[model samples]
Target: MNVFRLFEERVAGALGRLADAGDIPAGLAIGRVVVEPPRDPSHGDLATNAAMVLAKDAKTNPRALADKIAADLRGDERVAKVDVAGPGFINLTLAPGVFLDVLRAAVAAGADFGRGGVDGPKVNVEYVSANPTGPMHVGHGRGAVFGDALANLLVFAGRDVTREYYINDAGAQVDVLARSAFLRYREALGEDVEIPEGLYPGDYLKPVGQALLATHGPGLLEQKEEAWLPVVRDFAIDAMMDMIRADLAALDIRHDVFFSERALSRGETDHIAATIADLRARDLVYDGRLPPPKGQAVEDWEDREQTLFRATNFGDDVDRPLLKSDGSYTYFAADIAYHRSKFERGCPEMIDVWGADHGGYVKRMQAAVRAVTEGRGELDVKLCQLVRLLRAGEPVKMSKRAGDFVTLREVVDEVGRDAVRFMMLYRKNDATLDFDLAKVVEQSKDNPVFYVQYAHARCASIFRQASEAFPGEPFGPQALLAADLARLSDEAEVEILRKIAAFPRLVEGSAHAHEPHRLAFYLYDLASSFHHLWNKGKDQPHLRFVNQTERESTLARLALVHAVRCVIAAGLSVLGVTAPDEMR
Candidate 1:
């Protein structure tokens, strides 16, 4: 049960009654009202800005309105007290029994505990669109986990989600990949091949070389570059993409769509021309020359009135170039077509996950969507800051030149998927994360994944103890719901109940902000509450699960334990982490 939402409704309803009774002015909008926990918990259980928001509109003093709202809320059976704070904020203290009731709802809902419905709109989360050049690295791993968790959170909050990966197969990078693999194919045939500097130098392509030998040993050697580039390019890209797919599978991330950039232009689809034409018709495209970039500049930069998108009109730094001087479409051009394809395919609400190196590119891409959709569609870009790898508290250096850049697979193999996923999302996506190989494997509170998982395991231990305390007592929903929860009046028990009651509000806020790290924070808080209760049980025998003398009390405590497990498990599932029943 969402106690915050319930309290918000009561306060809002009371305000409307006051307006109708002429105690407050009529026709004031209350849509922007919010209720949240106070920063200082000692102030109250919850706080609302209803009075402050409505005061100016109602032409009434905020403090006076707050006093009237407080008086109205005091009449609520669920609210034990309502006090007006400074600047017209209302602090609500809920009845103790209401918290126990929240525990009952959490137990009844189980794994489905905090699931909410979409009151806004559907969203498309496109992530991990790494180039089809090589295996995904530790950098891509962060975006993949963050995007997946965010998508899961959106889905849990009731948004229809589409997890997508845009495959950049039709680029210069893919051509380089093809030539690199072809060189390996020659090496497989025992040819004296000197590796070139511009091509891929990683040893990861050895398997691709071996596979090419198995497919066509001697025939491709005599073929001209023109005749062989296409065949080898297609084969090598397929191999690289397969490797990326396997890497994602290791982290339990499966996208709903694998959109290909090549498919937009290479096929008879002609989507590029179609998309450009659509914008051109709207007078958003034109032939314009761009000023030379500041500082570092391209050597071959030529001044020409090239085809450009009117991005400046939509708040970009400059009108973006759509075509290179060589008459080939630029990367930005292809991206426009890609986003247009998303809009045409009914994904007007979209989010793209990218590395923080691409921060400067966000505004231009967002401007593209606005120019194309006429502000009809929304595009959110979540940029994940770099992940600095650590081992034993020291920096772990990566060498692209040494051909030993650590792959995503190696990180997963070292720490396992759950640790990798949790640590990746443990921080805000915009904040750089230091992922330590040593600390993540530790089974302690310092390690968030283990701490959260231990909470689940501790709850499981309580259930085991309950099974023994009441040998024949069933752990079914009906039996637990009927138990005398009034006996769970301890401060620690009530604190945990309060945490459980905050789940729905947490989900709503996370969904609204499109921030999945909020889930990580919530899980940390919930786990802390569970751990506190567990330690309290050690000091107070009555707080322990095995209430031997009282069968009803034993069942009631088990219900709370089981409820905490339910909330944590559901949250971990959203984060794509395993909630172990027991931690070894």
Candidate 2:
């Protein structure tokens, strides 16, 4: 149960009563009314803007309206005190029993404590559409983790989510990959070959060439480039995808679908042609000449007429080209078809996680979605900024294994999967993240993953100690749920409950805003509060969780600890990070 939502409904009811009593005008807009935790916890447990939001509409002074609302809320059994702070903000201090109710609910829910509350159409989260030409790098890893975590969050928030990866196999890059593999194949046949300037120089393709020799023998070596290009390209693309899949597996990222761009052009139905024809029928496509791009030399610029989409009509900066000068469909054209396919598959809610370089592509892609679905489809693009790899605050220039740029697997191997995943999500996707290899793995408060995981481990330690201190006494969820939670009346203990109560609301907000970083921040704050409370026990024996002298109070505190653990586990699971029972 969301306490914030519950209090919001309560405050709405109070406003309705005021309207009925003629204390304010009837039918004032209450949609703007919001109830949230006060910025300063000392002020109260919850605060509402009902009076301030409705004052002008109701033709009443904010303070006067707040007084009336506060008086009405004073009758609620759950609210112990209601006071108007500032001009019209009503702050509420809930009764002790209310906090106990949250604890009980948390225990009963367990891992499902913060699940659900959001209801919407199926969402397609397409991320890490990195070309299958090579292994995924650090930037691609950032997008992969962001997209996977986002999909997890959406699912937890009660939305149908499909994790997708778009493979750009039908592009020039794959052609280059084929030529590179052919050189390796010649080398496998004992011919000394030098990789040309425009070819892929990575040694990852050696195995692909060896496989080609083992499969088709050396017969392909004698064929013309035209005859052998397709066969080798197909084999090389498949091999590269296998390697890419392994890289993603190392980081625990798997996509529900791996869409091939080549399929759009090769299938019986030309999706790209179909998409362009549909847009043409709607007058959204036309032959036009685009002005040369600004702030660039146009020495080789050709202002020839090309098939274009009327993206400007739908909020894009300019009309976009549908096909390149070579008569092949442009990437944007295939992308539009890809998104149209999503709409055709009954997924109108689409989200794409791209690198920061794709920021300019956002508006045009969104405009295409609007044109395709007639504004019924909603596309949200989240661009993940670059991740600067650092070691002791010094720039990390190269990967130990990958030779040049850092590969995702190398980072995962060095710092571990949990540290990489959590640190990648610890910052906003649009913000440049400084991923310090030395700092993230450190067992200190500065390491958020370590601190959060340690909190879970500490909870397990408490339960173990409790089992030992109270022999033959039950300590599971059922026992904890039945504890006298009212015994947890300490201000510090109540503060813990307040944070636990915010979990569902936090999940809902993060899912709606499509921001998984918020969950990371919230988990850190919860861990900080939990760690602070654990430290307090060292100074005061009564605050100790395993109070053997007082079994009743011990059970109550244990219940609180279990609830905190449950919420932390739930949040970490959403982030695709483990909640370890023990640190070691």
Encode model 2's per-residue lDDT on 346-390: one tens digit a residue: 899999999999898999999999999999999999999999999
lDDT on C-alpha atoms for all candidate structures: 0.88, 0.92
CA RMSD of each candidate after superposition: 1.7, 1.5
Candidate 2 ranges with C-alpha deviation above 4 Å: 297-299
**Per-residue lDDT of model 1, residues 330-408, tens digit only:** 8898888888878877888999999999999999999999977788888999999999899998987764532757788
- Scored against the true structure, residue 402 in model 1 reaches a CA lDDT of 27
Q: TM-score of predicted model 1? A: 0.97
